[model samples]
Target: MLEGDERTGAGPKGALFCPSELRIARGERPSMIGTLDLLGRPAILIDQNGFVAAVNDNASKLFDDDLSVKGRRLFAADAQSRLRLDRLITQVRFLSGKPGRSTLQTVVTRSQRRPIVIDAIVQDWESAGDPLLPDMGALLILTDLNEIPRVSQSSVMEIFGLTPAQARLASLLVEGKSLEEIAFYMNISSGTARNHLKAVFLRTGTRRQAELVSLLSRLL
Candidate 1:
């Protein structure tokens, strides 16, 4: 997490604007390397000056042949991958926070495993208006595509405050099932299934089935 520590080399001025639980105020969003810990994503944040700012728990154990952090800088083992990652970082540093305009993504090919994604996104520092962190700093999210993503029922239930039936439907939808199939599988009437799905959509803040699936797919 982004604690105000000297070892990160981001300097005192570039520490995480949204601090971790170890050090936080009442309203910090805890984004990316800190707040997004709930998504179970592997991510690290870098300051505008190119120093490591913070790392999430999932990202800490990812230091191996594929990727590693050195002297407060992230490094890829392959020369080509490293070059691409550097370019992504440079591009993401200048991104505008206009919803879809905030992130740059690329796939990092690995030798022993399937390709992984490198998603560099602009941090939402401007919202907090903390002078210590720069607005251009980026958070790098690492995802291994080969891993079989399972739907976590508990996570789904908690995220949307769903009932057991609604959570089951949401999980099935994320797993690529149609509402008809889910209804038959769950031994519920088609109308009841649709009602449950509509309620799920309302609670998850999504309007369409596609939107709901897209939102839950991140958990995968």
Candidate 2:
């Protein structure tokens, strides 16, 4: 959810393609696009016009035969949902400098198993403010809310040579838990949790919580 407006549902939507001239005209740079392509999650780059700029390999595989984003627009396969998605894009675009979020839901049918419902998160991309890089447009991230089960606590302990307490703290942090929440969950004091986190950071060579999360994401 965002400040002004936030909505959630099944899948994605938007314009078909970027005009040849508009491809590199505004938004993220080539390097940024390349970095997005490397992510394990499904990611799509869209211009301010809501045109699909680039799609990652995971997104291609996630949607499979049902959808294609290469040069086509990113949208729901169904018409009604497609219109909703268009409105979502408009809302997000209107927010501009401030990031807003909307989610759409869609079920991916399998050969024999039950359909898997996935949420596509559409949000404005915050710029890095690098003098050399131009601001890119918002990014669409596709997540399967059902996809659970992550790297185990023991796994993190083994990877980082952390103690049981440090491993527990690390696992919670990776799950986006704050230090206060971690302390409550572990029945420990905030100072204890902070000390454990400091140890975790030293062992993992990360200076911040975000960096630790990113490092763990790559490792996992």
Candidate 3:
């Protein structure tokens, strides 16, 4: 049995804890909103009823004028964006009631032709809490694929057999970095870093940094 505000129970399959109860336990009243902001990723926190309880600043910026987005339906901002988001929500709900992991990715092009890609992962949040809320929801992460630095497809296909991780590193290289910096962050030696770049250039057929950056930007 639960004791002294300690609510315990089984939740949806994917998430083991109740996000709403967790929020409440953390001092967020049932009516309040909460949010967390992460660098390079936009996130939102929703109430049990699927309302936009809290949204990070990054999410707010996507609305054009950067107005507050709380109290709105989680996907009410744009019709197209809403449709895409609604699918994600449905997936989250399904995964909550069932078992296993799920990930969804979709690209959205605004009316102005600006493109944005969102990658979302749904999982169970388990905790001892109220039975009214589902133990599963979603943790959505947004990335602007258009902003990704690019290299020639041939170069990307050739050098280091670029995995997604390697591609991200290559993109960072276009932003300009010393071998030492890359080595320190990537946990590789300066020699390895040079080798990586050498492979990248050879595959892309670009001899200069400027050329590589310019080429990759267009490709992305």
Candidate 4:
């Protein structure tokens, strides 16, 4: 139920405001800000420069603060948060005016002392024709201490046309072992190992081991 709009302002690039869907937001009309607060997921609105404009109730509770975060540089809250946000921002920026989505995992400090892990999704916002808030930028949704979903071996095999053995080989490849190590562990010959790996690459349309690893790892 979260919503926001980008406005031409003296603030960050993708700054968002509550839309009409959330009634609890402090505005003359109903706004989505209230719904954002109710979501267990940590939601944040950022400006173009990647500064924190608004954070939902969950975020406030998690950080144990009700103080306004508006206009604060995203990274300013914590060094680690800053670094993570910077990377997300960089990815968003790289899309060059196209809306994009990306995910990041980072460690953050709770109550300015306790460390916690956060998984976040960064998405670009498209302006729906309003001139006042025209340059809408991005929305960041975060989950605390959760594992990112990964594709199972079966699913990966089905999607990439890998044989059962090749799929198992791909899984091992994602674990960072060398081909020889993988062969030894899987009780297969080196030649068979190379053959399985080659088939994995062809089925996955990858040309390099690192690329294959990255692609397969993200499936999960």
Candidate 5:
């Protein structure tokens, strides 16, 4: 949540675009820091100046020996990934609006066995409509190979507004299952499975199975 003093620092010109929720002083505490820790996901918040504002416990452990992130520059990671993070941060800072939100998929070598694939989402703290609080910065939500990603049937249905049958079909499609195989597993006829796929496509606004797969992959 960016608000208060942070917004004033941007001066009047920048304040014009300040989100409505940030216009008034509510003295809200930074709640996301605690929430991230509870979720046990590695996430960090950095100011536009590229300094780490806060880090969750998981992030501290993930980069335990490699880099000390809090209050330091994000470049402490590695040469290649540092460059990628630098660009991501710059992109968010310059864009500074809902349209400025973006995601970058990059790999970081934190071990000798294999590199960790990181999906970094850089977005402004605009949901609460405040960018003026002290140390209010954009978020860098990182998910790596070590994390177990489970997308439940209900989650897909709620996210895409799909019915239970449609959600099951879409999740199967994301797993690269064939239409016939899906029908067999669900104990339905191939035609019924195809019909569910059609409904999934319409609900997700995707014409092809590949497009539907891509959409669900991102959401999950």
Candidate 6:
């Protein structure tokens, strides 16, 4: 059994796929939320009863603004965003014991800012207190688009052998900058921005923006 987890057995695995780098070794106390914080992301953990169990340090910045935790429950300031958040929670709360998709994704939009991307992953609390997930029923990983990603453009260029312009474009996309906005910021015409984007796609082997964002986020 995981250290200090004698009360609960290991569940199969949470829906959130933890990379090898994020995993703790045997005999170590695993901190899933802590791992996410190391990468400069926010983690909101909920229990089987649909109550907010815990949140990491990075998550504190989100409170009283884009999101709020009231009565140990998480909520979005926007009505539509709150509805989507509630739906995701319900699905994750009941995801197990039923054959369904292993992962789900949704966007939590802010009133006057870029939307927050959410990935809701379910864990079996009955068998959970394992090292990986502890007592958490579900893990909500949030990527706020309004904030620029911590990834470095030089690293992207070196990893993918992309041109400086292409790497900048990738960084811009992750920053929630639209194509038009990116073109304006870079002082390039829209067509040129499209060309740079296509080049980045070929270099990174990512055909879509979301795919690129997911891949780049892992780099952090």
- Top of the candidates by TM-score: 6
Candidate ordering by lDDT (highest first): 1, 6, 5, 2, 4, 3
Per-residue CA lDDT of candidate 6, range 35-127, in tens?
887877788777755677566667656655567665567767788888887887777677743433356677877877888888877756446
lDDT string for model 5 (2-114, tens) is 33245343432233222232222344324575587676667766665555665555664555333433235554356776676667667656643444556656566564434
Estimate every model's Cα lDDT from 0 to 1.
0.70, 0.59, 0.52, 0.57, 0.61, 0.69
- Could you give candidate 2's per-residue lDDT for residues 68-115 as a string of tens digits? 443445645555545656765675466544445555554544443344
lDDT for model 1, please: 0.70
TM-scores of the models, in the given order? 0.55, 0.44, 0.45, 0.40, 0.47, 0.57
Error of 1 at 182 (Å): 14
Candidate 3 residue-wise lDDT, 1-220, digit = tens: 0012224423321222223433433333222112334343455554433444444445544544111232244433456766776776666666653445567776555555456676655544443243433443555555554453445445555653665545655777765766578778888887877877777677667887677677776654
Question: For model 1, how does the per-residue alpha-carbon lDDT over 111-208 read when each residue is reduced to its tens digit?
Answer: 89888887877755655464555443777788877765668889999987999899999999887889999999999999999999989988988999
lDDT comparing candidate 4 with the true structure = 0.57
Instruction: Write the number of the candidate with greater lDDT, choosing between 1 and 2.
Output: 1
Residue lDDT tens for model 4, 144-185? 543333347898879988888998888877767799999999
Q: Where is model 5 poorest over a 10-residue stretch in terms of lDDT? A: 15-24
Deviation in Å, model 6, residue 139 alpha carbon: 0.8
> Candidates sorted by TM-score, descending order?
6, 1, 5, 3, 2, 4
TM-score of model number 4: 0.40
In candidate 3, residue 158 scores what lDDT? 65
Give the distance in Å from residue 2's predicted Cα in candidate 2 to where it truly belongs: 32
RMSD of 5: 11.5
User: Higher lDDT: candidate 2 or 6?
Assistant: 6
Worst 10 residues of 6 by lDDT: 1-10
Better model by lDDT, 2 or 4?
2
